[model samples]
Target: MRFVAMCSAPAPLDQAAIRVRHTLMLLALLWDADRARVDLAHELRLSRSATGNIVNELLAAGLVQEVGQREDGSVGRRATLLRLKACAAALLAVDLGASHARMDLLDLRCRTLGTRTVAHDITRGPGATYSLLAGLLEQLLLETRIDRSQIALLGIGVPGPVDHDTGCVVQPPNMPGWDSENIAAELGRLVALPVLVDNDANLGALAESRFGAHAGLSDLIYIKVATGIGAGILLGGQLHRGVRGGAGEIGHISINEQGPVGRSGNPGSLESYAAAQVVPALAAQLRATGLQTRLPDPASLQDLLTHAAHDPLARAVWETTGHHVGVAVSTVLNLFNPQAVVIGGRLALAGEVFLDAVRASAVGRTMHINAARAHIALGTLGAEVGVLGAGAMMVDHLLTPRGLPLLYSIARRAGQPVAEATPLAQDAASRAPPAVSAVYTPHPSPPRSHPYSPRRNT
Candidate 1:
């Protein structure tokens, strides 16, 4: 869900051409519809002649098309409207959670062409899970009548720590027997597509930033509270994976030294105190305290939620859990001072009762200046956020300057690498003579001294 901006010192004409193409792709994606030539020129800060030339190149490549003309009120002649050919390529996206998997086939615009969800367990090990995934993908492709050759990329999100460079699971405490499994490699082999993998929370944050409530925000955090708890952090408009891709592991953060040990062997961790696994225990304690009766002890988080509507005790338990969540989030707000905090996952399904408590506690515990600048809200994407995020991740990668050639090579060779792909990309760039003078200027890097000022929500 995170993107690393490509930055380099002065480069050759070929490299500059790649940057121009990258900028055009970004503009097309953001515009989402036909845009006039003048608007494109203004947005990219390129001269009209340069914009026209680049647009012509894109038109020749079949990546973009002229969709008639825009009759503006200006005295000048009508302007041609250009839009991205969203259906020119497709991507496969998967969301692998602790107890279920969701797969989707999406077009370049991240629109779902087909999708399937199955209940499965990660505890069954990588082999079983992957086999299921392969079968589901095959079925989805068949159902959608999408040619395998058209699938340009695959993106997956897992509920565990991922070695970002290798796409391997690294000792995920919740997913037994998943350690060291190179999921991307296995999945790539099964589908013969270039694959990318990332943490589910991170993907959720990315999805939110691009398509959900926080779209266009530069600083935000997404907290997932479900079978476990994790945070997806976005700072200065990019994902912040720590040294080991464990930046937002708020669930494992020690909240109380004297608290019970969790699966990670961490005592009094946030997950140990407030995750779904503790719901039954909380229900039992409430029952033992002779509070208003619920059938028997709540067997699951769902039971707790179902009872909360009528049982005061169940509501109190949710409030208490929410407060713990709020405390953890308050710490996050103080440190990152993000513009918004999105609460998601199964726990969030409990609705406003849970979110209200979290908001109250977080605001009360944080500095007024920090709390005042932040807005905490339930995730708008609901259960589909992870899958949507996976799609967005692939779109982000494939549209990049370097990724464009890789995408073409994959399509040409059924996901096999073409040794001359880079050269092909350079050749394409070289053909755009008008862009030779349109140097790509990277976005200015944020200052390193203090927290960034909150960006206005778009």
Candidate 2:
């Protein structure tokens, strides 16, 4: 299931402060570069006096800094330029995969200060995995000379489904012995910080939505085709995790009834056909059929892509796999009608030969109305996407209205408590939006068996 990290809104009496803080943080984040108080006031649609009050509070809290002044052409007055203190705090991001893990230390602006990748196995279970990650995190802190107290939060991207609220791995097919393991709590204990967990693909989607090729789009999908297949869905400018956080398990969708079964015990699943594991297996199957080719008998997806330049058989396999993936994507297009479909992961490294095939097939199969509107493209973030996404998710959560209070609480723990301030003006308070909770919570039952058939909430 997909995990979100923000809590539901509190009572109306408490919302004014939350809304004012939330708006200030969002403006600071999106503005990225230095902006003027007048611009922030205009963007937030608040009076100059109100905007200045919020800015003053953020400045007092060490969240924002005024750097120099904006010299407009007019001779009237120079506007002071304000920007977020990008280095004020740090975040820890972990991308846990089936065969490897990537850890990164990022500043408040989600800029990487240090990163390291290590080979590991998730099937080794949570204890071993958590220990390995903790060690890696400690190493990073040492290398970067970042104090433990400087870390504000932790974001983790697991290959398997997670119980977002509890940070538990929930009956993941690829990760044995991980079921019901409270990953967040365990890691939080080690690092002494609140932790957020989510599917790796979902994190990738979030990263791409905020900073990658599809940065401005609200409706998009990120499909990661690696050792396994997964999709990250963004709809209506927000991540849609479904009722149970299983909203984007397109890999389990059956395409060929006679094809090989997947970990979900489903035959002809998309993952069984398009994942990195499938390339080698499909090669072996082709070789057994006495197919003449320069491609190795059992080749990695990388090896096949290299040979595809000279081997018709290797190119054919990629083409066929891409077509199969496209069929699944076509179904997604028909359903979600996203503005864009971004293809990522190891297999996507095969380049246009593979992407072209996916696009051609998906366009051919999808209805013209949906197909015409969706732009298919490759992901731009490369190997760092997952970690960046995780970091971005954490940052986004911490900047929310409810998250602001949590941030203050974290600051208190860090021995840098921010002083309380008066609430916003009555009219501004009345205009505050209701709280929308996105934080993960425990599910009532264990994750359902795959191929999971979600009941569509109409």
Clashing pairs for predicted structure model 2, backbone only: 1-245, 2-245, 165-440
Q: 59-135 in candidate 2: lDDT tens per residue?
A: 77666678888877888779988866555567788988889998888775566777889999888988788889888
Collision count for each candidate, in order: 0, 3
List the global CA lDDT of all models. 0.72, 0.72
**Residue-level lDDT tens digits of model 1 in 182-219:** 88788788778778888899988887876675676778
Q: After superposition, how far is residue 63 of candidate 1 from its true place, in Å?
A: 1.5
Candidate 2 has an lDDT of 0.72
What TM-score should be assigned to candidate 2? 0.85
